[model samples]
Target: MLTDTASLQTVLDVCGVFVFGLSGGLVAVRRGLDLFGVLVLAWVAGLGGGTIRDLFLGITPPVAVSDWRLLAAAVVAGGAVFLLHGVWEDDDARPAGGRRHVTRAVRLLDAAGLALFAVSGALVALSRDAGPLAATLIGGITAIGGGLLRDVLARQVPEVLQRELYALPALAGAALVVLLDRVDLLSPLTAWLAVALVFVIRVVAVALDLNAPRALRSTPTER
Candidate 1:
């Protein structure tokens, strides 16, 4: 069981990084950025969140900096996109069509990545003997921080700010993990169950095209 949990954590971490890196690389490609720029964005999107989480938890060296898995994920993501550049070109890659579809796919992948990172971060925090509140906060931040930085660097609004359900799903997942931990029911199975709940909610919300409350959207003139 312990081994399984550890393996799952590693997988989730790598998967989260991979998805985010892909999204970042895709964004660079959409902007017609150079290969170096794509790699830079991939690295930033993969590592930014865990870097912040580790800093907050005072984990020296940060998993992102210390672990080769993250670096590998970023490299794979950037390389994959760079290699696929020709395919995108051959497809005509209409910005409004191909780019939009790619962006939507990225958003969906991001939601899954968000769930994975939040659950992993909470588990790590709890393992380190942190309180539930701190664990939850760390988890939420871990999930959102990377994408937030990615958006900022790309000169776009962060998804969590513009989209109502993005960060909320992560927070819900983290909270569920903490709750289950308190009840001593939070094994890897339960942790994944929490992730599933978050992922489902997020997917449904996106499919329905949910938005932040009316009060949340800016006025058209503000645009």
Candidate 2:
């Protein structure tokens, strides 16, 4: 019988940030980055999405700046990755297949954070009186914004824009959130249910190597 409240949404938002932050740190580790890079990537990945969402919703100052929990979560995640990754070095004291072993982990974490943020963002938008379509769009943006920033900073192509079923699942979940709210069923239970649905869809797409169809084209000649 859990009810949706400000406290719950805040907790969900924090958890999303922490999880995305971990993925950021992992990406940094995989990229041969230094400690500072790990921290920067982590914070950017964690806060980028929420900041964008807040800005889009016309919320001044953005929670990523005003909230101490977000800062702690991002910093703690970066520190954890730095410490744990060092302990995982192979015989030569280099990271034990940082790319091979950590790549799947990064994708999985991205899926998780995407689901959490999508639902949370949708709920927040609904609470702020956003229209359903606007809420859905905001949710999708909030889910992927962090990863986009992280990948750009880490010098990798963003997964959302290029491949996989990333944005679809997030948008679907946000739409579901809007639906639930409109139906007067947006309780904590339903909120989490939407999260699970989005996560499952994204995870399944990853496992099955699914992708939305792109335009058919001949291979580009050397430009």
Candidate 3:
């Protein structure tokens, strides 16, 4: 049973990896990065989160390092942007509304990937003997860490810090997982339910243009 659960978790993680990898690849292409940079970001965005989680949990060699091929498969899936550049047909030529539509599409794609990482991360933490608080935190971290790493390496502000209600949804999903586990109700069904909840929260946030509170700026005189 344990092995089965682990295997399933891995498959789900791979799916999340592919989604995030595509996001990364798209970002690279937008930034006009060369092929090497595009592939590098895709790989980083796919596995960086899980790598952070494993290292924190004292899992030696981390899955990102040991199970690299799994991440590579995701990068391959993400290579669509690079391989099908012609399909994109040059963004400048597209209408402003069209660009906005694509942006929204990417946000939805990111929400799905975030949900997978958040829920699965909590499960992994629980399996590793982490307490409720730790498991929840780890899960939240797993959801955002890959994008965080990618942004840092790319010299851009992290999305979780600036994007619309990103980290909160991940944390919410992770917390729900912990709650379910506390009640001895955590199962594959409940887990996926948590993922759905996260995704929905993100989608709503996107639709409503929700954002985290911003820091108060000083008055002009104070400045």
Candidate 4:
């Protein structure tokens, strides 16, 4: 007897996981990682956040570990990327033509996945009677943990630290979900609003090339 909203949330959760897994696989292909590496990245990106969420709630085995579907999704995504690379390797021009567009699309989808997972994670935390602050932390971690793992594997600075509007969007979305839920305004509508907020923020940040502040170059006198 799952409620309609609950069911919708479930769908969103799985969809986010699947897309995130696909993004991981895509990146692995671009990097020429082996099949095992691709699948490892895919599973980690797809399930890492949810697993953390479950652990925080003391849920046994974690949802991602317990549910076969999530693993299946990651494996399928990895296999698809591996096979597609085989087909694509024959064409030098095609990679040049499509690589940028595909990368852009993957980034946008990753943003969407982050948004959905952040809000959904907060919602789940709330449902489990977690404190608001704890819920927000859970939400934020769930949103970025996968990407962090992916970056570590790829030998890059994690997205939250180096990328455009990444952590901020997830933090904002999680906070919004908690606030709306507290005010009795968190429903399907509010969830969508939160997602849209995160998505737009991410898109704008990417478009504007927003980045985290770094140490400025020192003058010769200071150096």
**Among all candidates shown, the one with the greatest TM-score:** 2
Against the true structure, what is each candidate's TM-score?
A: 0.91, 0.93, 0.89, 0.86
> Of the candidates numbered 1 and 4, which has the greater lDDT value?
1
The residue ranges of model 2 lying beyond 4 angstroms of the native Cα positions read 1-3, 89-97, 220-223
Per-residue accuracy of model 4 over 1-223 as CA lDDT, tens digit each: 1235566667667877887888788788778789998998888888878888888899888878887877887788778877886666566467676688667866886887798889888888888889999999889988888777877887766778764778888988999988997888877877878988988898889989998775689343422
* Model 4 TM-score relative to the real fold: 0.86
lDDT for 181 in candidate 1 is 78
Residue pairs that clash (backbone atoms under 3 angstroms), model 2: none
- Evaluate model 1: give its lDDT: 0.83
134 in model 1: Cα distance from truth in Å?
A: 1.1
Question: TM-score of model 1 relative to the true fold?
Answer: 0.91
Q: Which wins on TM-score, candidate 1 or candidate 4?
A: 1
lDDT of 4: 0.81
**Per-residue error at 82 for model 2, in Å?**
0.7
By TM-score, the candidates rank as 2, 1, 3, 4
Q: Give, for candidate 2, the lowest lDDT window spanning 10 residues.
A: 89-98
lDDT by candidate, in order shown? 0.83, 0.89, 0.82, 0.81
Residue pairs in collision within model 1? none
What is the Cα-based lDDT of residue 204 in candidate 1? 90
Best by lDDT: 2
Tell me the TM-score of model 2: 0.93
Q: Which regions of candidate 4 are displaced past 4 Å?
A: 1-5, 85-99, 218-223
Total clashing pairs for each candidate: 0, 0, 0, 0
